[model samples]
Target: MISPEDYNRVKDKVITIDVRTKNEFEMLPHFDWAINIEFSEFISNYEHYLRLYNPDNKLIVTVCNAGNRSGQTSQFLKEKGIDALTLQGGIYNYKRKFK
Candidate 1:
């Protein structure tokens, strides 16, 4: 798992997965760097992310509103044999600290 500060240092090299509902993401302010994969469809489409973005050992940073969903997503990815981890606090924290 990467700290928000550490992640920010290499933000360009990381892929941020926002595992929040599409509506939730839209309702709040937007984050250009994040890709939304709603919690409901996360498990089914996770493989696609594993295949497309960072297929061959690329780093992934999973994020959620406050970290719960992203934390779960990290576990799911780890179970699937991917080296994925969660963002410490998620977008709520990101916006507060960075934006």
Candidate 2:
């Protein structure tokens, strides 16, 4: 997992995937460039989402409220050879550090 500081370093060079539900996403603070794919549909529609935003297969940064879901997503993506990484403390810690 990468720290929020590390995330900031590559934010512009990578694709940020928010694995939160649509409603949660709407209610929470988030990055403007992040794509909301939610965890449930991430695996099934990953390619489509990637095609819609980042077809170049850039490094992917997965994030959630507390890192759990994002961690799982990162593992799955890594297994599929997607070169994905999870945000070390997720958005909660990220906010604490950056807010």
Candidate 3:
């Protein structure tokens, strides 16, 4: 899990994928560069995004409203051979750290 502080330091060095629902995504403050793909959709559509990202070349950072969903998604990505990471505490932690 990557801490918010560490993420900030490497923010430009990683690709952030937000696995929050559309509703939650709309209501929350997140990174402008984050790609919003709901967790449910991620299971089926992730490969497409993976192709677009070429995960092997970039560090993928998964995040959610909290950490649980992103943690699961990160595990799945890892199993698929992508070098991925889950943000510790997710958006909640980011907010706490920044605001």
Instruction: Choose the strongest candidate by lDDT.
Output: 2
Model 1 score (lDDT): 0.80
* Tens-digit lDDT string for candidate 3 (1-99): 899999999989888999988888888877788988999899788888887765466898999988999999999989988888999998888989888
lDDT of 1 by residue, 34-68 (tens): 88888768788877766776766777788887889
TM-score of each: 0.87, 0.94, 0.91
For residues 1-99, what per-residue lDDT tens digits would candidate 2 score against the true structure?
999999988899999999999998999988778889889898788878878877888999999999999999999999988899999989989989988
Model 1, C-alpha of 31: deviation from truth (Å): 2.1
Q: Candidates ranked by lDDT, best first?
A: 2, 3, 1
Predicted structure 3, TM vs. truth: 0.91
Candidate 2: worst-modelled 10 consecutive residues by lDDT? 46-55
Backbone clashes in candidate 2 total 0
Q: RMSD in angstroms, all models?
A: 1.5, 0.9, 1.4
What pairs collide in candidate 3?
A: none
